[model samples]
Target chain A: MKSKKWLFFVILIITTPLLATTIEVCSDCQIKTIKAALSVAKPNDIIKVKKGVYKETNLIIDKSLTIIGENQPTIDGQLKGDIFKIKSDKVVIKGFNIINVGKDFANSNTAIRVQKSNNFEISYNRFENILFAVYIEKSSYGKIINNKIFGNAKTEINSGNGIHLWDSKHILITNNYIEKMRDGIYLEFASNCEVVNNFSTKNVRYGLHFMFSNDNSYLKNKFLSNGAGVAVMFSKRIKMMNNQFLKNWGTASYGLLLKEINDAEIKHNIFEENTIAINVEGSNRIDYENNNFTRNGWALKVRGACYNNVFKKNNFLYNSFDVSWNSKMNDNLFEHNYWSEYSGYDLDKNGVGDVPYRPVKLFSYIVNKTPETIILLRSLFINLVDFSEKVTPVFTPDFLIDNQPQMKPIL
Target chain B: MFKILKYSFYDLIRSRWSFIYLMFYFLLGVVLLFLNNNLSNAIVTLLNVVTVLVPLIGTIFGVMYYYDSKEFTELLLAQPIKRSNIFLGQYFGVAISLSISLIVGLGLPFIYYGLFISDKIFEFLTLIIVGTFLTFIFTAISFFIAISFENKIKGFGIAILVWLLLAVIYDGIFLISLIYFEQYPLDVFSLGAVMLNPIDLARTLMLLKLDISALLGYTGAVFKKFFGTNFGVILSYLILIFWTIIPILGIVWKSNKKDF
Candidate 1:
């Protein structure tokens, strides 16, 4: 009797794939709309929509279904309301051009919204003129890939994010091109998420931002020319690697910002032509290694309350100021870094310089005290003052030295 | 004006000081380029040298040239030539010669390093333009100072003082004032102050192109609107030209009224 029950269970598991059915939706078909198709879709069914324009809004998917487009169908929301409110597990949405989602601030007005679901996939879709592209809330184990999201974002308060995650975990977001949104990707209380190889640019606010999120990692991403670059704030134990932050040049812009972050590792990243490459405030125990800081205004600006951060094997190339600190106290370690402004000789013929290199200049310290002193940059008096300060350290912390300055840049 | 301009210009072209000035820039360009072997990097270092050294050299050379040429001037005053023609011609002579040295000196190393194929040619051009403008403006001011005073010591002293004020002390005062009034909005005031001084205006022009304006914060925003766009840049160039013209006009006015 037990063997017969086991055989019957195996048979049922094998036959579940055969039980799934396909429903076609076309302009001339009996089921003309996605709403009509979804009304009859049971669990484990496919809704294949043919090539045409379907003016739909506020459609809900409540059952496990695969919705595929035959030739990239267009679903125009017509500035009405939310497009697809997905609330089912194991759902798949693919190959659709979604446009004209409503611009409603109170409702957050998303093109595709997923809530309280898992094992979902949203891929190969295009969204334009949306308030929010994809809003994932209370979701887990989902993949959002290869979606091009472009919004008409002009102001911070009037726009929404491209891919937003709230209270989600173990999600993978990859290969998405996001532009002109409030933020390209925003995570709030979202953890264990992997964001990889995405190009986010020209957002009204930050390209990528995280608030109160922990254990998240982003790798191989390119963020360019946004209002500000990636800001990881109030997060812990994050990993950032192989990312390119370029041309985020503005008055108050930084390539990366860390506030109250702990135990994070930033490696193999390139920060080029930003106003401030990395701005750190109240961040502790972070390891910065193998990064390139190129032609920025201030390569690193330590605001306050930062400690135990180690900078090693990085390249600082042709920045106006390599580092700027507001205080005379430092608990950070800068070692074995290649500074293009380093003029010390190595008499021992080793790779390390015999003399220590001080990265902070007296002018930068004065600029912090009097922001107007920035206008005096590259002036004769400032250079003279900085040279005297370098000879005898007084204003800057005496102990803040890179004793093992590399003779050549680390490749 | 053309005859006197030609005589003084040819005389300056044959002088040793002009050769030294040209050689100074040539050596600087060569050393900077060969040391770094990077075009953009050399341009950055050259920015500092150009902004500071250009004005200093122009001012000192102008004053010294004026005093050394005093006998020549008195002899010419006894001739049939107009006073303004003689002074303005000398002014242009000094300015044009210095500009030639700066351009030919810095430009050779850049062009040899394939600046045409490289993308930093615009920045290189901006640097040369700013350098030339600084030369003309400073030379004109120095000539006016020389003409106003008969005492050689006082003339040289005031000329040095004026250059020091414009090149160094003015920035010091501007920075202090901005810090003193930090509670108020300063973008307009700062921009106005920068526009009034030829040195500050030239520096701002170069700094804006170098992406250092981003450090100015909100003030940088206002400056970006005023100095970042094509209209603003062209307007700045017009202001720089005005800077050159006003001092030259002052030289003419003072020369016409002088008893010497």
Candidate 2:
């Protein structure tokens, strides 16, 4: 009996080393394809792809494998098909330059398609000229981090998105640079996703386009120079904080477009040089706090049908139009917001102004009526018109007034 | 024509794949809505769901409905009816059934929320109707595609690709043009550019109705100036209606000209 127990212990120790395998894949090696390497790899195995342009087609992995490319290996789709198709849990595809995915106008064909996978880490890959760089569908608990996706999309008729996620949950897309696609990061029916610290610029459409996605948090991202800055629609309980929306300048361009969003907390963000800082509609129970709006065309353009929104402790500086509302009055509360245009004195030396500052400009009212009057912006007549309207508010909504504008810039 | 409509409805309802798809989508929408809790969030969620699911289902179902019913279509053609009637009936029936399923899956939640919880009931209802109509538009396009292609795989593939373009790719193209002409007066360009996309039109219309067109800045101002009033709103609706009707009419014209 003592000999049998000793034998069992010896067998257990011998088999542990065989479980974790490390395979190397080179361009001219016996196993040339990533799929071939993944086929034979065991769980927890590391398949290292060597540096070279691999003109491979679709690669599917069904095991818990770690595919790491060394020296920034290139996986060229050759305009044929998807590069990596992951169907396993705990899979990592990293450090590869994926390019030239086939453009299929009928379906969302992506470079990296993750399906029914969990605990994935897609990091440090460079994607160029692809329909969709990274696509996650029906996947859960994935992290798409530190990837660069750029496309030269000329027309909306054939171009694809950058990072397209559908029916995915618990996703973390962080610290990536995405440009020149339809959307930098698109979330459709995705939930509990966290998009952080990414730079999305020069996209054909929205930097971030999310719909029907809920309980998401987008923090510390920079959205710049897109057609529209970002659109958060049909979502609830979203938290957007500490982001920079800059230079999203266009006729219809905006820093952030919030539609049908509820119970959101937008705080500590910066909106600079956009056409409109925040275009809000049909949203409710939102708290806008500690934001800096500088040099935007309109700092906050509040449409009608919004209710129970609170704007507090935000700094509005040098905006053309501080606020423009369509209706006479709204239930949305604007208090403690620092308006640089505030003329009321603070004799008591408190930070708060003595009198309430009305943020809605009279020129904005004129522009609302005759949009052609916008050509006269920055003119003395417009300034005079604005001044007279401030002294005696007319055409502009009567009750749409900012009650406690700050005496000094909130900085 | 009536027989075609009846059969199309019967086929869609009878198919196990459609049932499963509807069940999955309904479950997804309901679960997401319940989780969102807030009306704005729910609306965003609903929009996202509709954007992805509507196009996907429309393309796939439309393609498959035509392909799978080929034998039935031939059998019907052997009878004494006009090809246009058969095609129109099938098209309308497919559109109606899919729209009903979509309404039940996504629309019902918004209605439930609007009636029980919020005041923007009419606005939400309008959005749902627009979404449903958009799906019908896509379905009509899919029918044209199905008739155009000889191979089922090719037709399905083309339909999916078109869906991707409309749902995701078109926005990318708009961004590129905006960037390329960054030095020019972009507001006028944007107004004209956005009109090229029906989805963008729907989105703009919804925003206008919500009185948030000003948020679009110069572009929004221009849009409001042109369409902010009741007349403007009516014009926007007319554009949407034109988008829907023109494509279907084109398909009808093409179907009549071609020997299917």
Candidate 3:
């Protein structure tokens, strides 16, 4: 009988590391705090938090675990510091209401921060009044999905981004609704990220901004009424498709501002009613295809040094200036685009216009040189002057013409 | 003065000219709303028409009414009515009739198209208000010109010239000068130039509401400060009111001194 009891004890000890036991945490339980529960948890343990308000701050997770909250338990940080700083791989945090993260200039007080972690899933969470929501630094293979972040960002001086990814790769950010942040989603030096189906609106700066981020593709994200709109700068091989940029109207605002970007593919996008849609500067070898630019101030403003860009099958409708160029130099190719202001006739019954359409208006050139001249837009004299300039190509770049202008808008 | 105003108002209303004007606006509103099918964009197109066409109609109608009623005006002058009342009453008559034609003409089609329920109702109201202001302003200028000149052809010619200058040529010159003086700061100067002309003031007011995004795109701090707030609207109203009053005062002065 003594030998048999020893054999059972040895088997029980050997199987303890593979089991994932659930620890219940509530106000009335023995382990009341998530911090206390996490301290006693194993690598694959599951912590279930009950429905209650827990005033906690700086909860660090250094081991792989699953933290699930029942009925959206509110974790009020009380404006102290970062909450739920994950430092280990394979951590999952779900169904928590986080609020009141502190604002510090040096170290951002993030709601859910993952540092040097991999395979983390922060989903089904709500954040409000946060300095930085979901701050991922040096994290890879993380999915920040289905999270709603609302920030009280009144000014750009002290505001932080909603989902700030720094040096993170292979991250998936999808189905997030972020509002009133400094920037909705900011990525710096991050690569191979896929951001899809996010609604970012009313931010103080760009809705989705990228700096030196490469091999990223953002699809079907809607950026509306942001202060400066979206900017993809200093990036290479970025693919943006099927996005809607609407009503981001202000002084010096645009739907998208691409600067020094190379080999980017922008297709199937809608730019509507923005001040300036798609302001390109120094971007090379970009293909802008099948996008709709409607009712903007300037549909496309090539500021300077944009070369080898191909604009094909895009529709420019009712914009004040279809294409405005600053310098007279032209190396871009515009083909098969349908301009609403194209008055040319296709007498041969072909889909293309008989004459090539010149889009760079002399008045827009003048307005670019002396921006105050924009006040004379749509005036009779300005129209006459533009007409004369159109009749005789002078001041504007003569080589900037759509050789095959579509008679009908590409659906 | 009220009697003369009523008489002139009825006289213009009963004429086929007012009917044509009313029908023109009705057709314009109907075609714009139905064809465009978007309330905001239709209002923009209507604003373009209102800024240009309203002044042309107002100037020509004012000058034509004055010359057509010349002998009747001389008869009224022989009566106990004051000269300022005589000229001012005729001016108000033309202005009010034209404004009513504009309102009733444009209002019917818009109200039919569910403008009151739409969010663009305020923009439509601004367009109407600016249209009325333009009507009053240009009519006063034309009346002053008609009262100052005795020769019928000369008055008509000068009236047309003044309209052309304010509507088209002035803007031409303003654009040229702004481009020529591009090296200097031109915010205050451009605003002053816009305020000096009633047509330009009305257009600026309309642009403040319609094309605010593009207008604010200019990098001038003064321009941004002015257009970004309600200050530009208030100043436009003040300057537009000043424009209306100046011409009426000119009519009063010119009529009081002239031999007609």
For model 2, the superposed segments whose C-alpha errors exceed 4 Å read A1-18, B1-260
Q: In lDDT terms, how accurate is model 1?
A: 0.90
For model 3, fnat equals 0.53
Residue-level lDDT tens digits of model 1 in A270-376: 99999999999999999999999999999999998988999999999989999988665678999999999898999999899999999988888887776756766
Q: Per-residue lDDT tens digits of candidate 3, residues B1-260?
A: 89999999999999999999999999999998998788887887887788889998999999999999999999998999899998898999999999999999999999999998998888889999999999999999999898888888999899889989988999989988998999999988998888888887877777788866454545788888777788889999998888899999999999989975
- Relative to the real complex, the DockQ score for model 2 comes to 0.04
Question: Which parts of model 3 are misplaced by more than 4 Å?
Answer: A1-17
Which docking category, incorrect, acceptable, medium or high, applies to candidate 1? acceptable
1 versus 3: better DockQ goes to: 3
Candidate order by TM-score, decreasing, is: 3, 1, 2
> Which candidate, 2 or 3, has the higher lDDT?
3
Going through the candidates in order, what is chain B's TM-score? 0.95, 0.89, 0.97
After superposition, the stretches of candidate 1 with alpha carbons farther than 4 Å from their true spots are A1-19, B148-158, B169-196, B219-239
Worst 10 residues of 2 chain B by lDDT: B210-219
Question: Which structure is stronger by DockQ: 2 or 3?
Answer: 3
